[model samples]
Target: MPRLPPAPSKHPSVLGVDIGGTGMKGGIVRLGHGPKSGTLRGDRFRLDTPQPALPATMARTLAQIVSELDHREKAPDADSRVGVCFPSIVQRGVCRSANNIDPSWIGVSLQDTFEDALQRPVTVVNDADAAGLAEARYGAGAGVPGLVMVITLGTGIGGAMINDGVLVPNFEVGSLELDGVMAESRASAKAREREGLDWPEYALRLQRFFSHLERIFSPDLFIVGGGISKRPHDYLPLLQLETPIVPAMLQNNAGIVGAALAAHADPADGLLR
Candidate 1:
């Protein structure tokens, strides 16, 4: 397996933004020299996602976050770049599919939009992929061997697959069909809430979904993330599976940290290759 290029030392920190359905968040992340070495430089700045979340409106809101975070840093580098994690399947800076955000995002060049808005180079990636990269490098999956699957149980299921510290971007396992329905439709946190399922009920759905994944991919490890990860005891143990499972250590910050890591590495080079 190929190793990821070292993060540039001269620009030890960079801004990472996570664009979500309900909020947009950003922060400066300090890159360290070893595994699990990323840390937030200061408090993260957030703003409500615009109601429509169209490309232009979202870009403006993102610019505000970038401006706020840059101001807070107080020593902005003109050459420093920005990394954004968006809820879509991004390919070569363009969004191929929209999830949670506006349909207008489809086919939009997130890189160009954000760069035009913030006046800096931008690296855009899938939110789940960003979270997985962060976990694989600086959180739960750090130093873990073999294939690791990072699953975010949020409003919808989000997934990332990493092997030997290399990320396989946009895995989209949540879209898999389970029992004739989209897996996330029945297993996601939103589903649990919508159906008023207790932990045990939710675990039953998760068990089916994970078991399907196990039969197909047989990943070595599973890292469950999102706000629900804070309460691993509530659902993790209830589901019986062959693969070892753990909660994400970074919680909500994984996407931000991972986006910074991607920016620091320069995504054009193929992030985490």
Candidate 2:
């Protein structure tokens, strides 16, 4: 008989980190019991991220958060795992580019940095992918089958593709050239700021953008997420498209919950670092 590879290590609990442009949000998630369909609040915290934040600073902050979570009897100390939502194009185990951090972060192994600081396992995934997974599992895409595409229209338009409940990361549709300009530059929250438009106008542009996306991906389900998702009914009605569209059920909690779910799903991988 052929020999099998050694079994991978596993952890009992996870520290879910959602790294954003303005703040770093996280929580200690035990294997069971958390927000179901975006109820929110299950041991979470948010802290402002420093400008040009060094990888070392990120690691230190992560360590502090995880250490506190570990101190609680409810979560594992030595065996706790960490999952991060990084705003960047992640390739293999390195960050290709960071949207919310210093350019020096390019080519850095964020997983390695966090692991070295906390002496635990760690996994770093694109922020959009994390949020998409959450939506697919417990939010808008729940029970829906086949292709599901989620677009987060915040500072930048972030995207994640889920087919059969799996995440296809690093799909920067936002950067695609539309009419000789970056789509995100004209369609994202940045555009709202640049154009001095409100949600209604922004939603109208979103409708036009989604129309293009529908033509390309032809997703069976499309979800709009991000902070703006909180009032999706208000703007979602304005955005017209061919496919079925809905607001993400998890809203703000989607990222953290999804990060935890990502770590928990890959049980054999131990910590992401």
Candidate 3:
């Protein structure tokens, strides 16, 4: 297999936006020479994801957010690229599914829409894939050379599989079925909250779920992500598995940083669309 592009040096910066169910966040990531070296150019910005979350409605909000970020720069870097991470399966710039957002997003050519809205090139990808890429490149999974699986335990489960820093986008482990139900429905953080399962109870479910993953892929490392990762003490200690599982280091910023890193790489590179 061809080697992936070398990571950008510490000079260039790119804008990365992560669009989620409740809120959207963005920042400018300065490319760096080592893991954990990149820094946001300014404070990150967030805005509410439009109600109804329709394509056109969300596009307008995203445009406004990008403009706001642009205005913050004293002199905008014309070469800086923009990347947008969506909470859906994206392929060839087209969205394949919409679970948290409006169904209208399905089959939409979001790449064209965002490029038109921003008046520049924009790369779109799955939000989980973006976060996983960041973790593999610069966070918990950094330097691990074998299969690394990063799962986001949020309103729904999202997964990304990477090997030696190369991302396998839109893996969709969340869709796996267990007990005739979507795995996310039973094991996601939201599911735990909705079912009112305490830490130990939730940990048991996660233990079974992750053991299933280990059976299938035997990943070298597993990075657990999402807002709940902030308190790993609540759950991480209870699950026992052969694979080394750890909380994500970048937390919510992973998607933004990873999106920016993607923007810095060649467009034709074999990352997800």
Candidate 4:
């Protein structure tokens, strides 16, 4: 497996953005950039994504975040790049679906939205993919190779594949149909919430969910994350599985940081069409 190079000290810090259904989050990250240039200093915070979030509303939110961060840069000469991780399927730069957000978000050109508003290069990616990238690079899958699958169990099941070192985002394993029903229909924490089953019951189903993922991805390492991952002690012990699974090292902050990292990597600013 190819190795991801360390973040060099000479490089400037990359700005990371994480977009969610109700809120947007971000932070400046240094990656491996050294003690000063790439150091992450602030906490992740939220801004409402607006009810019935249309392209305009979302764009406004992004512009505000970048504008604020850009002011914080010590050297006005160093232009910062923006990375945005969206909670929807992002192909090229277009958000194909707004599963977790307002229906107005469908077909939104996320990259253009950010760039047009902020005038900074913007890279757009799936939120899960961003989280997965963080896990692969600095968290659970660090230094390990072959096949690494980062699975985020949140409102839905998010799967991202990293082969050698490249990221394959928005795998959408949750939407897969199983026995004439959707997999997430039974396995998601949301599903359990509706069913009124306890965590143990949910965990039993989660075991089956992970087993299915194990068979499909055949990942050498599994990094499980999401809000639920915060309580690994609660039900992870009840989960039965084959492949080795570990808690996502970065936890909830992975998506925000990964999105920022994406901005640093994409030359054209990772704009979607």
Query: Best by TM-score, which number?
Result: 3
Steric overlap count per candidate: 0, 6, 0, 5
Candidate 1 residue lDDT tens string, 222-252: 9999889999999999989999999999999
Query: TM-score of model 3 relative to the true fold?
Result: 0.95
**Candidate 4 stretches greater than 4 Å from native:** 1-6, 9-11, 33-39, 73-78, 266-273
Tens digit per residue, CA lDDT, model 4, 131-246: 87777766788668788888888777777778767676677877876547777788766787889889888888888778877777677888888777788887788877777888
Error of 4 at 36 (Å): 9.8
* Root-mean-square deviation per candidate: 2.1, 4.8, 1.8, 3.2
TM-score of each: 0.94, 0.86, 0.95, 0.87
Q: Give the TM-score comparing model 1 with the true structure, all chains together.
A: 0.94
Ordered by TM-score, highest first, the candidates read 3, 1, 4, 2
- Model 2: per-residue Cα lDDT over 46-112, one tens digit each: 7777666888877777777677666766564567567788888877659897665688889998778
1 or 2, greater by TM-score:
1
Clashing pairs in 3: none
What is the total number of backbone clashes in candidate 1? Answer: 0
- lDDT winner between 1 and 4, please give it: 1
Candidate 2 clashing pairs? 121-271, 121-272, 122-271, 122-272, 122-273, 123-272
